[model samples]
Target: MRLNRRLFLGNGAAAATTLAAPALLAEGGGKPRVIVIGGGAGGATAARYIAKDSKGAIDVTLIEPSRAYYTCFFSNLYIGGFREMDDLGHTYGALAANHGINVVHDWAIGVDRDAKAVSLADGASLSYDKLILSPGIDFVDGAVEGWSLSAQNAMPHAFKGGSQTELLKAQIASMPEGGIFAMVAPPNPFRCPPGPYERISMVAHSLKQTNPTAKIIVADPKAKFSKMALFQEGWLEHYPGMIDWIGEDFGGANVSVDPDAMTITIDGETTKVNVCNVIPAQKAGHIAEMAGVTGGNWAPINAEDMSSKADPDIHVLGDAADQGDMPKSGFAANSQAKVCANAVRGALTGSRVFPPKFTNTCWSLIDTDDGVKVGATYEVRDGRIAKVDGFISAPGESADLRRATFEESEGWYAGIVADMFS
Candidate 1:
């Protein structure tokens, strides 16, 4: 905005090339157009930051499929009965009402990179000077044997929030006494490294109170998982004899499921389960791939700015971003969003850009008032977001510390929702 021509040359593109894009790519006086896709931890935060900081100097449009976003971060707690579904749902009304962001509720079906536009499910195309995609994740085709989207009703993934979470909770509540609950854990490089284990703990917490005799069987493709020792210790202390974890050593990866029969086969042994929660291998949402930004499963990004490695004018955030060492967590997504927001604002408005510093803490509830966490502070190192310092809850932390940890997660939930929407 400092110079008349600067608006057209956002991202320092040459004037000739910038004009080759869609006609909506702001000219001399037109405000730069920023289109953000998705409205969760990453996209919502990105849109809010860009809109608030730009202060009407930039046109920010947020496209999301849902009016009320359900966070996947605390969905496990919902399954554990610690929170109701309503507690996790947040509306975009606040974003539009307060920030002047054009919040459009629609699904992004495709992207026209040459034209610098996004195609919507409703047949509308939005032209963008800069595109921010944080569409979360999608399951890999046939990642789990005999498990597919059509079978989700019977074997609910419940990986994403909302109705699937509710369905999983209802299925758990309807589980007969002494019934077996099986979890088909995903392989490496999936969303939320500690998520499935936390869910197991939460499910155990629920079954202990309602059906103590119920058993949980976790079939994990990986040999070990995040905070394995801490979760195992907590399981022994709180819900002893409730969880049986079968890792790769025990053919846990050699699994298949029959949704109709409600049976899971692990290493040629088929067991009937009252509820089957399948967490399949994950990749960036299809829109990212459709945009030709994804390297493989995830969209690779520059650690310094969260800009796409493929396209400097495009950014990827949240679970979709391959930012090296950071795990796929709500906290990590929000951190990356701020860095991307700063970089994008600087590109479009010629604002002062700050050095990027990112931190992420993944907290999981082991039981009531019993929480454990693993976290790290990251910086640009070796051309990727690499850990500089970190911390994790120990195997035998004090009950007081664990309780405090649970309270901390609650506080974080409130702060993050406000950070994203309010």
Candidate 2:
């Protein structure tokens, strides 16, 4: 649906007076201003929904450095050489033209919560009646020795799905026929729990075709991973002898990588590899800390409204929020964005705000047609995210369901992008 500019302008004028005070809502008959930081899954959805639902009652501005976003969700397909960059990348033209969102191609350097303004790296300040922050995860430096941003040039993380992904793909292509490719999995509460394994599967798929003698070694800290059984079954059946997963017991817990030496140590044993993808521990994006909205690595928010515990006028969603029982995936972020949007509209318009129900589903492709998924419905109880019911793909499921899941995942991606940008 397209935005009704005239209707939005009129309603926004009235909303500004009620929410931001008559003086702040309009200096000379303007709409209520909203500044959203980060234009990924959560922020983009929040900005689009607020502008659409407000009908001109909210002037939405989105701050993001990239004009186009490369989704990490299905980026493995690109690594597998089955999809092009354009297939996974998305632009914000719809958000700008149809939704009337002011898309700012710049970074948010800081937030002055007391002043209700955000500072951009371009030396501009954006004043807002309400602010939304959905900056995704950031890798923790020093978590793995010799694995830093500078060293990533040699051992790419490929976690955020951009140039790093391409770099990792090139490394995979250059591996010797019998070379070893090692992956260092991160700790818990990180984005996309099944991501590392899926990456392994995709890379192994490519290796099996090009370098059949190559091996994939996953050095994981965790004993059990999401969809472990499904992933293992797929690996053994499809790419047998090529993929080897090492759990904590198998000298896999805790890693220290030396980029200079090009070696990774686990449990006092060192294994030099042709390529390494070390995904370090993650935390809320840097902006969350600059805004003083986070504790430790995550921001705590009221589950019902998604407003920060420290600042009620500011909301934090996506991987930045400490949403218990919710896997930090793009689907979860997109779902949370809608709930936050409804709450913001209710609060600003003096309408009734009901308790919210959050739902999420994450799909991972083990191969071109084989996929696995996990889903859950959540609610707020005792001021925390609590799961009500859900479904995970059963191990040893029929091949038909596995194939169908992959197709369904594509449809879900299309729908979510439309919901966010269109």
Candidate 3:
């Protein structure tokens, strides 16, 4: 039988699959069990794909805390008022009913690797033949001075894309007219490299429409950012004299915030702000650490199949996995999940396992109908996922092209979310 995988990727890109193994019974006198932690793009895709492709040969369970997951990908558009929060929200009800997968809405607190089991916050344990960890990202403690989980309400990071996104939007809307909005950008190697800049553009968009004279200051540790020229050009053309981006060369590297006092200090020079957005340094989610699969901040994975380097039975995907050359993106996570799903299913069902091919595209909307993107195809080589070929939107593109790009992004969002939940 032939399955055209292009349906999963919005762009009709096909990935061929082959199966090799004979079907096997469950882990213990039943269907083999696969426990997936995190119900976001990676984990959800893995669980659904495994269960769907296994055809009753394997049992899949997903553990996630949030009943409704808000995607981080196009969240900036929501902030810009291009979309509502509900537009980005997804649920696992489809996974439960349509796919016949077990969806557990709980926190996975521990992983007993030796016992091949996961412990839940509710004091229940689940045994699995294979485990998938895609717990996303967590902030590095003390990475930003004067910023902690306690200060999140005051300076919403809005990076995780749920209530935080709403909080940040409300804060922006409530900013005093002509007020100063400051952002402390995270360091390199963080999730969604272009996210902060896109957010700045979106915030500027909102501010321009409402508080026209409001100013924005971005204190960034990196001297340059993803699609720098493109974003800079767009900012200049769309919102001139409204943004002041301070790179590390200008002391943006040394920064601190006073949440209580509503002040930000860069290079010992403190300035009060109407609203502050602090994006701290990030690492693999805590569950990856609890699973004892993390190396420093991220869980190392074998690029060939997204399996944890520390434990072959455990696979890591998304922001948590340190797979070389693949950005920590929802699209990349979904791509990795497909490859991982194939491998896991192959091992359990003796299905034909084809070589893995991955693709990713990250699109950022600068303003209404103005978008830019970067994308690439990847392959595993020499123990790392390396870029094979790539393309990017250039700085000076026509309005029609930019509009088409944005439209393409809209279609991709619809496609990816459906690929995950529906």
Candidate 4:
């Protein structure tokens, strides 16, 4: 029953079943309880694996406010008209009915570490042997001047990828034929580093077809960005003379917006725009802060187990955890969730705990059938998740290769969501 990193990496599903069957596979005599907060990729995957693998021996409860969860991943594609809203939404019915999970639609207001209990907004409490928090990201208040949650409708961040995404798409579609679309990109260490730029690509794609005369401008605070050369090349090739990207060196660092005026000022130069998308700086979701697990803006965790450094009984996942080398993407989150699920099940059931191994790949669509990706495999080293090997799409890949890559991403989206929700 001794499990190692290779077993976890090469045969994860089989390894998880083996570890979970040792002490927990049958119901009846006072089972171990696990409560998971949030229902995103990380939370859903962890909850499902732990519950399904352990059979009825683990009483699993998933506390999520939304009944239908829409993914933030590939949300840019929705703006690009590659996907529909209904196509991105998922339900908790399967986790409840098929997997025997207690899916509660409620807010987790507080976590009492010493008591090992979570207080819900509905005036009820649930105690647990282990608590999993995958609360996602929340914007830092006043991170972007003149833009707050109140102004989200006027200038959508669309980072959450639900109604906000839909609103942004509608706004872009409704712009005047020759209108100017401006974006205020977030600073570094935000959720999905390449997100805003990919969004810009999608917006440009839609406008290029319908309103060929329209323009796009980005005011970014970072001097450089993820996949900068690749995205720049794509912009030049697919939508030439359509996008203007201003980096920090070119006064992109100095930016502010007036939602009411539909304007953005960069380095004392103000320009009026017909549509604005302002994505602000971010931090871990507030519930993690409430749980006292956050260090600065994110929660710290043990790379071996994804357990909160602040509390052994609590684990943090996804964008909320400050695990080095892993980007805050849904793919990374799902990968970490599987590793965490294995460790948690092992700890609870006296099963063999495996050395943690993880992987993530982030894909972006430049245009129709044009795709690019960057990815890496990781292992625990020096008490942090360190990248072992990596690869990225080159600047001048063939059209057929790029199209094949895009097809690969589409298949991945279908696979990961099914791995998480179904």
Please report the candidate that would top lDDT against the real structure: 3
Worst 10 residues of 4 by lDDT: 1-10
TM-score of each: 0.93, 0.92, 0.97, 0.95
Highest TM-score model number: 3
lDDT of 4 by residue, 162-232 (tens): 99999999999999989999999988798887788889999999999999999999999999999999999
- Give candidate 3 regions above 4 Å deviation: 1-21
Candidate 1: where are CA atoms >4 Å away? 1-25
Give lDDT tens digits, candidate 1, residues 275-332: 9999999999999999999997999988888888998889999899988899999989
Query: RMSD in angstroms, all models?
Result: 7.3, 5.2, 2.7, 3.9
Clashes of each: 0, 4, 11, 0
Which clashing pairs does model 1 show? none
Residue 285 displacement (Å), model 4: 0.4
CA lDDT of 215 in candidate 2? Answer: 87
Off-target runs (Cα >4 Å) in candidate 2 are 1-29, 351-354
**Model 3: per-residue Cα lDDT over 45-122, one tens digit each:** 999888887776888999999999999999999999999999999999999998889999999999999999999999
In Å, residue 15's CA in model 2 sits off its true spot by 19
What is the overall TM-score of model 4 with all chains considered together?
0.95
Off by over 4 Å in 4: 1-11, 20-29
Ranking by TM-score: 3, 4, 1, 2
Consecutive 10-residue window with the lowest summed lDDT within model 2: 8-17
